[model samples]
Target chain A: MSAAATLIAAALGIAAASVLALVSFPARSVLVVAVNALLGLPPVVIGLVFYLLLSHSGPLGWLDLLFSPAAMVAAQAALAAPIICALVHRSLERSWAEFGPPLRILGASRLRALPVLLGMNRRAIATAILAGFGRCLSEVGAVLMVGGNIAGHTRSLTTSVVLQTSMGNLETALLLGLVLVGVSVAVSAGGIALGGARL
Target chain B: MRKLSLSLAVLLALGGAAQAESIVLASTTSVDNSGLLAKILPVFTKATGIEVKVIAQGTGQALATAAHGDADLVLVHDPDAEAKFIAEGHGILKREIAWNDFLFVGPKSDPAGIAGTHDAVAALAAISSKHAAFVTRGDTSGTDAAEKRLWKKAGINPAGADWYRDIGGGMGAALNAAAAMNAMVFTDRGTWLSFQNKRDLVALVEGDASFINRYDVIQLNPVLHPNVKIEPARKLAEWLAGPDGQREIGAVAQGGEQLFHPDADKVYVPGT
Candidate 1:
């Protein structure tokens, strides 16, 4: 369940960054600043706000998002998008600063610069996605708030580990912990591989 | 230098003495939020002079803490898990101390029209069939466990239902979610009374056999770990179930409302 959520978050992050990068003025710079500030937003607070929005009395209560995987995905996406965008933005900004003069010297048009910018920051974008995935995979508070930890449905690896540990199932919790570590490692490796292929 | 060293040694000795034979007690937030511990523990301290540090988590987590020996004693409400803990030999000398009822509260709109239905299962079914939003304490707390039992009794699986929302959080948080969502929830009467932001929710279905929630005090079995502080733990448990303990439990208040009715006689029946 967590794996699927992380995949969704990664896709969301990329899509969000792409939109922000294409539409905004001084796009990379704006994204970098916004993402850096958003990185500090507490996960618990995010969960609480979403909890209200999705609850029955809240305006969006009709959506019935509370305690669903969709709610968890929304939380993970909110948490991951900024960091992913920021990293990609920074990478693009730095690449622009370094390559702008050279590209101009080579008679490159402004139109040609966009693809060059993306190519140079391919690894940075992958790193951003990986970071977002890591944050979503391990988060307890947001998931707990939004997902409701239903055993077969909303429960994720982190929440399960906490639950198992609390239930005095140390061995199960430890095994789950190991699985979390493996997932993290696999995600990082995948990110690097994908970034390498892109570059 | 010798005089300074002597004073330092004296300070260290005094600090250790001040620390005394302290034991950790993990209990339900209902007890903590109700201010029962403050009234009761002083009596135990006066009698045994053993200091106790209370850590409040949900009943599920409280039992889990005792299972890991993270706490010397546990006071929680989930009967099935409590029985399982004792059966697993993680706890010993368990006894009921108090009980309260669970209330099904929801928006005054009463979308499900569950009011007066004394059957909790039927009420839940009505709420589900009507697709009225229901907030569940998905945190696996005792309330969550009871909610699950009710859902099962209703012959409906709420897991993937669009209206059954699981906010995997403590009772208070879950109640808050229910209130904000204008959704129905099953909560301990104690937490519901103390909850400040109930919005427009009111108690819809209550006073049923299934609504009875009992709390127990148990000392972790010293047999499991020889290092367990059995004597102090026993002292605390005994004190809690005794006269002074009952008084303390009865006296706990929130907004001038008594939070729990301590059943020292253990004669408090569930359904009646």
Candidate 2:
């Protein structure tokens, strides 16, 4: 879930961040603010919305993704995209000031400079995507709401831990919780290593 | 980056499409959480070579999933919902696979003095009159449906009452919450038997005919849901009600006592 959702979120987030940094639209600041505000949206609410959408009765029910891992990936990606977008936008805005004028002087279009900007801030963008990965790795509310937490199917480390805890297997739950923490910690370390210590 | 995304997407599609021939079974938490499936599902798969992917949810949601064609079949315990589902042509077969009874599990204090009572309705009324803390699984699960029926029998709404607690979660969650606050909770015997966190809770009421939990295995209607894997699901339903499956179900014991009494042979009517 973390890997797939993070990758998908990275693609969408980077595109959104490029628009925010490159474009001079009237509501650009509003969109930036909106993406930032979306970070405050509880994962549970996002999960519920996706649940309604992916349910057999929902509009997108024809996809037949409900109670499937694909549905979970979609929910997790939706949950992580905003976080990646906002953080990448913050980093892109800083570097765009440096890259924008030079690229414009070189007779480059905003779309053409998109790849150049992405290459220049690859480390920081990697950092933002990893942050989104960690969020997806640890998120249970949205995953459970959409995944149905099916045994041997949609069950994940976090949802299983929640199950064990409710089953009064606190010792097992604690061990699983440690695994989750350890994994996220490892992801953070990997992000730093890949980002070359860039934030 | 494009190569990476493509591979990841392929990996995800593979993950989701694992064992494509498998049948999805939507069941109640009580059946799955009781650890009975762990003992029998492997054997069932080995005998049939058809995988059954079990997704445990509330009976309400389980049936709803099958109705939506998201699930091929359901193994659940709510008669009212099952009847409605059959009436609506969402499912067919409806063979009784196992049976258990609901137990009034509450704090050992016996605040309402319901221990040893066989009359669930009276016990509930006493609990309501005394205003004892009663935790309810308001998530529309099988046990929650039974609790509602009991409350109605006792002529008490208990909706806005201070003593009533609606946890709106699964059976395990409701039991955990009940254990936390030392509140009374009505739960199926299978879950109650496997529950390890006794804490201050005890069985307050039992042996009521009204609390009998009959689990039925229903196949998705082939006529209505032409997309369902009806053949494999039907084979599974038959195997569950067959001699071998019934033996396995009845043999599953928790705390040195059988959790479920197999009722498949005793009562299964065709085309009902």
Candidate 3:
């Protein structure tokens, strides 16, 4: 339950951050530095921020989503956003530098040139997504805090590994660790296929 | 963008209703690590057909979770925190479900020579004087609070002592660190009994009257979380205070040692 939710969260976060990075690339100098700094936002800090936000007395307490899978999703997304944004922004900047002059010479507007630039660097974006997804998969601190690690409800692979290890269920922890490795392999393999399969 | 948000909304709605027949119980790791919940909750489910999903954390974190409106009920061992939870109107009431005691475990060599002493304070003092290795769980947990109280009573501040190691983790991790360092650790009887890897550690001091540990179950106030499963939460709390629950708890043993004694009838009122 938590694994799937985190994946969704990572995807959504990556998409949003990547879009903003791509669209605002040429216009904002300060945002570039800010995005770079945000790449180091520790997972635990992200979890704490979300915990404060989703707590009963928090501003978004009306949503009442704490300890739910949705909250875990939100936490993972927050944790992954900065990494995706910074990396995708850097990759998009490089592509723009490489393709900008020729595209402009061909009378391609910035709006029309954006998709071509994205296509030119599809592999880098795919790799960035894979790295962001890996970050989401291995994250334990943030998701554990926000999701509450409830059994059959919000427990994810990483949290389950921690729980099982602490409960003296070493074999169960090892098993879950293996499952995490397998899932990562599958996701990265699929990412490789998608990256190579298209423009 | 529209499709993504729409799917996310559907997923959240589905997750909310996924466990309608179940209730989320946030309890301490001591109880779960003892394997008592596995022994007792199944019987409750069989009788009531209401599945109980448990999230085992420290007492402080468990109460925090309940206060956040994420948990339907909480089973924890910190009385002061539990009281504050109720005083803040987060919970209905606190019911004592079971009781245990804390024990000091250390290297079997007994380097501090505090073994066989029934006084934890004296044992702590002796350990401090000797500068013997000691491991502490410093995560603001119930066990951590108890250790702090003992340290205060002993009039000793071993925080920066080279012999003292404070690892901010759960009970199991503390025990593991104790075993690895062959140091002294204060632990609940439940986790101590169920722990499989002892290494060079042994229970050095016990039987302190001040070491009594009590467990309580508190149902969150329905008004605080309108969507909480109050009916099942109340049912589970009542059942735990009743005969079958007590019997199952008492029946669970580790290495021929009973981990907890049920005293709900004597100490806790069921419905209040």
Candidate 4:
């Protein structure tokens, strides 16, 4: 359940970042800094805020999402979205500067310029997705707070590793930890492959 | 200059001599959060002169830490897992120290209407049939394992659909999530009473035969790692099962409510 939720969150984050990258913004440095700063926000803090918003006492508690995968996804998305968006933003900005004069001289419209910019920075976008996946897969604090780790239901590889490790089940914990590492490595390899394909 | 150098050397030697050997104890969050160690450990130090460091984690993690010899001793609940540890030769000389029961807590309105059911399986099934919100501690802790067993006994698959929610976390966090959602959740009574976010939720079901939760203390076998402080670890475990430690365990408090009952005298045979 956690794996599925994390995958959904990664997809949402990448899509949101792609849109943010496409939209024109002034003061590129400020936008990049704002997004980058959000990348460092603690997962537990995000979990806490979500708990407040979705708990019975909170405004949106009616949604009944306090311990659900939805809550986990929301928390992960909050953690990953900004980082993904910032990476894509930086990539597009650099690529745009490189391609700007030539496209303008060729009489290309802003609409035409977007695809060209995206094509140039596709590697950066893939890297951004990989970064988001890494954040989602390995996170313990937020998932522990929001998802509630209910075995067979909400347990993720990382949480399983933590729980098993705590319970003295080193064999199972090590197995889970290795799997988590494998997932991360696979995501990184995919990112590299995607970047290489673009080149 | 020579006299100053000698004085500095003496100070460094004194500092080195004062350094204590640290023994890591992996224990439950309930014991850690209740501030019990602060009250208890100083006395142990005074008597034994060995500084003990407590690393608080859930039962699962505590057991795993001991298995790896990352910790010298483990204090945790969940008998089946503890037995597995003993059988696997990761731990030795397990002793019962304290116990508490699991409680079903939900919103005051009782959306699932399981208020008085003594049968945990029946209560879970009713909650599912009603399609009311239910919070699960999906984090694979002992409480989570117990919850899964209840659902299995009830013959209901708790995944899928909007009614069942998995909050992958510890008991306290899971309880808070249940309280927040006004969803029914299975939690240890100790954590339920100590939890700070018990606003709209109250204990709806408890005192069933199936709700007993026991905590145990055991030392990691020094045979696994010769460097492990097995002597002190065994002493701590023995102390926990002895009268003094049992007394200490029975005396833990939250708002004047006793959080656990010391069960050192009880023999725990699995599947009983």
Question: Using lDDT as the measure, which candidate wins?
Answer: 2
Give the whole-model CA lDDT for all candidates, comma-separated. 0.73, 0.85, 0.82, 0.71
Candidate 4's displacement at residue A195, Å, is: 40
The reply for model 4, stretches above 4 Å from the true place, is: A1-199, B1-19, B266-272
lDDT by residue for model 2 (A50-76), tens: 988987667887666777787788888
The top-ranked prediction according to DockQ is 2
- DockQ-best of 2 and 4: 2
Docking quality of model 2: it rates as medium
lDDT of each residue in A1-199, candidate 4, tens digit only = 3344334444555455555555566775566567788878888898878766765446775554544556676677678777777777777767667877789799987668877787776777667767877888788888776665544434668877765543334577788888889878987887787677755
Model 3 chain B scores worst on lDDT over the 10 consecutive residues at B263-272
What is every candidate's C-alpha DockQ against the true complex, given to 2 decimals? 0.02, 0.49, 0.44, 0.02
Chain A TM-score vs. truth, each candidate: 0.82, 0.94, 0.87, 0.83
TM per candidate, chain B = 0.87, 0.95, 0.92, 0.87
Deviation in Å, model 4, residue A118 alpha carbon: 37
- Cα error, residue B16 of model 4, in Å, equals 8.4
Candidate 3 lDDT at B163 equals 95
- Clashing pairs for predicted structure model 3, backbone only: none
Per-residue lDDT tens digits of candidate 3, residues A1-199? Answer: 4344445544564455446544655647776777778778888999999999988678886676777787887777666666766776777778777887898899998778877876776787777767777888888999888887777677889988987777667788999999999999999998888767874
DockQ of 3: 0.44
> At residue B188, what lDDT does model 2 achieve?
92
For residue B261, model 3's alpha carbon misses the true position, in angstroms, by 1.5
Q: Write the per-residue lDDT of candidate 1 for residues B1-272, one digit (tens) a residue.
A: 34334433543443344235777677876665445675677777787778876766788877865665556788888889887888888886777898888989999999998886798878877888899999987766777888899888888998978898988776766776787789998888887786666779888887889889988888777777454568888888887888888887888777887878888665322223
User: Which regions of candidate 3 are displaced past 4 Å?
Assistant: A1-27, A104-109, A193-199, B6-10, B222-228, B267-272
Clashing residue pairs for model 1: A55-B181, A56-B181, A57-B181, A57-B182, A148-B168
